[model samples]
Target: MSKSYDAARDVFAGWEVDTEAALTALSQIPISMHCWQGDDVVGFEKKTGSSGGGIQATGNHPGRARTPEELRADLEFAYSKIPGKHRLNLHAFYMDTDESPDRDEIEYRHFIPWVDWAKEQGLGLDFNPTFFAHAKADDNLTLSHPDAGIRDFWIEHGKRSREIAARMGEALGSAAVNNIWVPDGYKDIPVDRMAARQRLEASLDTMCAEKHDKAHMLDAVESKLFGIGVEACTVGSHEFYLGYAIKRGTLLCLDMGHFHPTENIADKLSSVALSVDELLLHVSRPMRWDSDHVILQDDSILQMAQELVFTGLLDRTHIGLDFFDATISRTAAWVIGSRNMQKALLRALLLPQDRLKEVEENLDWTTRLMLTEEARDLPFAAVWEEFCERNEVPAGLGLIDDLDAYQASVAGRG
Candidate 1:
């Protein structure tokens, strides 16, 4: 260990916080890095379409991956810079195959390449059913569409996605979280909201009728507020999914940017943990809107990590990043976001939670507040640097030059 790390360790020891233990715990936790960032949500589909579901990757950044091979290479580079083992969160549309199959006709064979790649990289995989960027979703209504044919089409796609996810999980020996998020809502005030929700519920029932083993796959539902087109109402609101998750025994996905601007998802963690068996967090930074900016070590992320640690819900919560900033080096974006999340978790792990809870239980508000504020000034940087060294990744700005060299190499993609 470095001299700085040894000094920091002594400081933490005074507070009854074991620095070694914190680093070990942080290493065990894996952040599911989103693959959409590599290609700006433009999957390797032969018949490409618009990304119209309130999901837009702004900026014509150079060197965006044009093929699955390129994306995988970029992801490989990203994983190298980031500390600890991680998982890849893939969307259904990111299939790598020569066969042209519509969304509903997709099968596990189409994504065999991804599974093989993940095996080689020693990474787990997660999945999502893409419900946007197609002709059927042009109206921003999918499973809840008034037209029966359109709804059935989306329902079949969802079913196929689940099957694909199960295969991936079984192949990798980990439970792949198949999260479902749809852009089904209205732009203007609706005449009757009840019918749409009822239809959505019925469609979901049919889509999830075939149960897969929990060890191979887990179902999760993600809810969003109003989007670009659906400014009036989002069909799968948080309330709807929370209730559905509780009743159906599925994981509830809480996306940081999917809620109101003033709403803090950190506060909802403990409350929802009581009802849902597991949770899937889409950690993101929303700039004014659901801009999906790269996350930082901000208060929002810190409090979220603190909640998960304090409530003892870390085991049940799957951490996944959700952002696509095409404005910067895509690989650097992945590295920065993943490292920030790890830093937040490491900070949380080093907290004197037992003492804080003890003071709070005794109604000593002053000490509780003081200790919490004082904990912020701990020598977290030294400890973090040590962690990076141990993980064989660059610490601090050491990665900037490497990322710049990588950008130069890939600039020819234009």
Candidate 2:
């Protein structure tokens, strides 16, 4: 260990927390870095006017990835800065294809390049079916569309996406999480909410009927409160997905930005874990709206990580990032958000869980509160610096200078 790290480790040792043990636990948890961050969610598909599904990436930062090669290069640079191995989260529209196959007809051959590249990097892949930014989705509907042909088109897309995810898992020797999130809703109050939900239920049943190996592909359904256009009636609300996940035995994806602003998503982990076998967390920071801001080591983030550790749900939760800020260097955004998550996890792992539990069980609320507050001031940074050194990544604000050098050398704007 470096001299500074050794000194910090000794400080943490005084608190009765093993800094090395915390580093080991934090390294084992994988945070799926989103591919969209590199390209501003503008995929390789040729047929796109703009996102009609309330998804808009703000700012036009220079050096945004324009092609598959550039995006992969940016991702590689990002992975090198973040400590430990992590998975890549991809959307269906990002397929490396020149034929420009429509969503319904997209084949696995289009993503072979992605799988090969991931294998070389020792990363697994998670996938999502793109249900927006298409001509068929112009009505703000997809799987629950009133038109039969439009619904069938998206259903077919879902089916093909599952097959691709399964193949990805088999190739990488890891279970690929395939998530379904659609922008199907109305701008005004609908006459019949049940009708729309029933159609969606039927569509999901048909799409999930052909089961892949559980060891290869894990299925998840996502929900949202509202979005840009469809702010009145979201078809796939939290209640809808929660019931469906319990009944169908699928993972329920709880996006941090997809709920009421006042709600704490961290509190929902254990309640949902009781019924659902697994969870897929779309970790993002929301401002007043569903603006995908870069994550920070804020209180909400720390609470979420602590709950994961305190409840022993780390093994059952699939943690993935879903933030896109086009105002800054895309590579730096990746490194910052990813490292913040790791820091939060380290903070969680360093908590004195046994001591806190003892106080809480004995109804010693004062001591419990005091101990928790004191744990926050522990030498987490020291442990984190040592972690970066061990993983061969730059520590702390050191990444800022490295990112600037990269932009000046290789990622300059035209």
Candidate 3:
């Protein structure tokens, strides 16, 4: 099999693509797997009414993980089927607790078990402050709420979440990316948009004023244009977060589904990278609006990987998956989305980037276009199969059978 990969390597070598270097690069890039996928975003937090805020996870899949043990089991299984080491993204609401603590009061103790488990699995952890799906967010506000008390509570939660993330990083010896995203916006026209934006800025400043060691945690802020309910405007627009990140020296999160339908977020990467120190990518598939659909091997994803590789920004970019499709197998969703991301990256790495750059730089537009089209017909499938073989996972459609067996094993349990 190594010789087989070597033979495929020869094909890549002809194009000045180092297959070994590409494989090594792909292996080093870590994709943060969202924890909500396993349980349909229904965290362990105690809540009375239906999920609030702008977020929603449709469908009622049968095999959804009902407990922490079950979710971790599903995550373990999903991670096993994918290549490369990865990180798990955890929302603060996904705490493993016997007694519920208010979001603001949550401490490092609630997530110690998760840190232990992640260490055992050789996986790093990323943290997010769950600004949605709570009574505090019933009015479609959190850090940006006009009410000072509500704003204060969420600010405390943000601080606590960051602390917990830092502790996890220190314990696991890998810096955890602590991300903040709030569903703060209006459904219709609002005369006081400035007030909300100002409140959000103040809250974020208060939360991020105290700095933690960068070796342990990196703080990032995410923005969205619109959502299911917030159709009119989103407080944390890309512009707002971009300015905030640059000024505050924080990482900016670029969620694939967070921009306008016609906008390609890949274009923003270079622009943002020029100012921001690092980036956190929430790789997702959006149907029309910000619908969190499972990712596929689509054009946008390919362009995203290419942009990252072409700009040579892979090391500074933190890749993470963000989607929940309750209509399909949760574990399979994890495997499919993560693997597709890896596939996109591998293809990007296998590209003759230097050759393409040379033609474009010299204004050889026709040759550049021809090369772009021709590169698609290269032996990408062969190289991908070799990656799967090297990773010891099922090659090609062989994963479907493995998924079927897993389904059978968990069929009767739920």
Best-performing candidate as measured by TM-score: 1
* Model 3 lDDT-worst window of ten: 46-55
Q: Give the true-structure RMSD of model 3.
A: 1.2
Q: For residues 1-414, what per-residue lDDT tens digits would candidate 2 score against the true structure?
A: 777778767877776677788888988999999999988888899776655466789998888888888889989999999999999999999999888799999989999999999999999999999998898998888899989998999999999999999999999999999999999899988999999999999999998899899899999999999987788999999999999999999999999999998989999999999999999999999986579899999987999999999999999999999999999888999999999999999998888888888899999999999998887777778778888888999975688889997776555655
Provide the overall lDDT of each model, using Cα atoms, as 2-decimal numbers. Answer: 0.93, 0.90, 0.90
Query: Top lDDT: which candidate number?
Result: 1
Residue 154, model 1: Cα distance from true site in angstroms: 0.9
Model 1: residues with Cα > 4 Å off, grouped in runs: 49-51
Indicate whether candidate 1 or candidate 2 has the larger TM-score: 1
Write the number of the candidate with greater lDDT, choosing between 2 and 3: 2
Task: List model 3 lDDT by residue over 1-414, tens digit each.
Answer: 667676878888899999888888889999999999998888887653546566678897668888888889999999999988899999998999887798988999998889989989999999998888888898888899989999999999999999999999999999999999999888998899898999999999999888999999999999998876788888999999999999999999999998888899889899899998899999999997678899999999999999999998998999999999988888999999999999999999999999999999999999999989988877777777887888888866689998878867776665
Per-residue error at 273 for model 3, in Å? 0.7
Spell out the clash pairs found in candidate 1.
Answer: none
lDDT of 3 at 179: 95
**Residue 131 error, candidate 1, Å:** 0.5
Model 3 compared with the native: what TM-score?
Answer: 0.98
Summing lDDT over every window of 10 consecutive residues in candidate 1, give the lowest-scoring window: 45-54
Q: Against the true structure, candidate 1 has what lDDT?
A: 0.93
